[model samples]
Target chain A: MNTNLYDYAYELEKAMRSSDEFKHLQEMYKSVTNDSEASQMFDEFRNVQMQLQQKQMQGYDITEDEVMRAQEIANRAQENEKVTMLMEAEQRMSMTITELNKIIMKPLDDLYGSMA
Target chain B: MNTNLYDYAYELEKAMRSSDEFKHLQEMYKSVTNDSEASQMFDEFRNVQMQLQQKQMQGYDITEDEVMRAQEIANRAQENEKVTMLMEAEQRMSMTITELNKIIMKPLDDLYGSMA
Candidate 1:
């Protein structure tokens, strides 16, 4: 109920916006958006990720063919300048968020500890 | 790739640990952990949530019986003092995290825009 938490959270959000990770991510994303070829490549990459994630959630194992197909797209994505930059920027930002999540989850972790 | 982001993130993490919301959530969680009945009730409430999530992920619509059972457990959770406080604190903290996530995803949101 205290507004102090919201204040601190908002402050952090603002800080994230000003951070270098967000800046580079924004730049790379814009580069990809302006290029149709790059945009399509990025989209395909994301689709593969989503497909893999869906299969994982359904308790289904991905086939070797699917893995090879995904790898092919990934290799292609990495070869494209805009797509490569965008992916790297995305990973950088994602890593920051992942680290932040661990910090946020500390209390629940404490509760689960041994039981988890 | 920038160290400054890490510095800001760690600063925010430290602030979160010192925030009233985290402190209150910690207290409530500890209270529930120390109480056998309260912990059981909290666990049951979480189980219902996980069950619903699993069903939804599997593309299944929950039956009315399942809905009623979930509601029953939820009602009991709200009635339990320890569970109530812990849940409230969890929601309060979760709201902050959700808001933060929006800020973190701004670049991706911009990239997807109408396509999303």
Candidate 2:
């Protein structure tokens, strides 16, 4: 088989690393980490978020109280300047990834539509 | 800003193209296209699937009858040898893309914990 696909994968990886969104994400990450309070808040928020996801993925029902608490923590974290910046950067990176996925999957999409 | 992310995206595209799953998908696509009957069946299947997706995306509820009809078409299409090969190939390709997406999104995953 040809090595073209692997080569493209490597190139795509490089591009993602150099993208503005990724760079901004890294920068915001450093900024947030430099602030002890912001870092702690972000960490707590992340923990709560992960637990919720794990529960959902495991097919466990999350209580309304748990959901509310998680949202509250996220809201508090967002109030922090560093956390807000980090989130925006993260969103940009996410959008970039979504766009790239669409481009990369075009062939499959054209051939199979949304069936896959 | 750095261009790393875009570069990575390109590399990833290359890798996906060169992957066995992708190559097989292409080959299967070619085989199905060469057979008129299979190609027609596949085209119809794709059309139905796309229509359903569009409706769902538009927030329209798909009636039970529509769902059953779509499933029937899919079942009939799968019975064709060429269509079956194409579907299998597509499944492999979809799996490969999913895996690649996971790998590419690791950093974001760790940082945001699925919040993004």
Candidate 3:
């Protein structure tokens, strides 16, 4: 596994969170369960990501620049935190997955053929 | 007037670029001007912002974390840099501006009245 696997995982997670299909499922779950189970799952995922990031940066001393940058990030997150937009974008992109896969087919096959 | 004016300006610029109204304008300009004047303007704006940020950070030493963070940002920008989505989001939000303004009217009036 590549060191970038974590990055890929993160992107996949983000993509799933942003997807229309996922949103529809979430809405369905909410209606059926009469509870925000999907939303709670998202919060759990975010908490895990935060914990992972905190653990990753454990030994590093927080600098003034980091403090300023963190504050800026927090401010932006608080102000324009549109999780739905992200999900919607993912949904739009999900609809194109087949097209994307078709576009990559030749290159992926070639790469696999070469390795084989 | 405010230190945050730049942020607001940046958001406005982003909003314009993402808007269907603006995208149509851009396509029209490209078709007529036979040049991507709108896109060029956006590039110039981005360059100016970069220069301003560089000037702001002049006295400070760039830390390892900054370097890493910069690389991460660059990679993400390269991969999923959908300027269209940002513009679309802006367009979507722009359409709701009147509604947003209506929502904020009372709070704004209260603040202004207090200041007066």
Q: Please give the DockQ score of every candidate, comma-separated.
A: 0.28, 0.25, 0.02
Writing each residue's lDDT as its tens digit, candidate 1 over B1-116 gives 65655565566666667777778878888899889999899999998999999987876778999999999999998898999989998898788667656764564576457455
Q: Best candidate per TM-score, number?
A: 1
Task: Give the 10-residue window scoring lowest on summed lDDT in candidate 3 chain A.
Answer: A1-10
Off by over 4 Å in 2: A114-116, B1-23, B26-84, B98-116
Of the candidates shown, which would achieve the greatest lDDT relative to the real structure? 1
User: Residue B87 of model 3: what lDDT?
Assistant: 39
lDDT measured at residue A39 in model 2 versus the true structure, 0 to 100: 91
TM-score values for chain B across all models: 0.85, 0.89, 0.28
For B2-116, candidate 3 gives per-residue lDDT tens digits of: 2232233333334433544445534433332233444444344445447546744453445667566555544443343243333344454445443323332333244224423
Better of 1 and 3 by DockQ: 1
Interface RMSD of each: 4.5, 6.3, 20.6
What TM-score would chain B of candidate 3 score versus the native chain B?
Answer: 0.28
Candidate 3 CAPRI assessment class: incorrect
How would you encode candidate 2's per-residue C-alpha lDDT over B1-116 as one tens digit per residue?
34555555655655665577877888888899889899888988988999998876555678999999999999989889999999898777767666667656666666555333
Error of 1 at A32 (Å): 2.6
| True lDDT of residue A21, candidate 3 | 49
Docking class of 2: acceptable
Writing each residue's lDDT as its tens digit, candidate 1 over A1-116 gives: 54554555556666677788888887888788889999999999999999999987876778999999999999998899999988888888888888867865565576457344
* Position A17, candidate 3: lDDT: 42
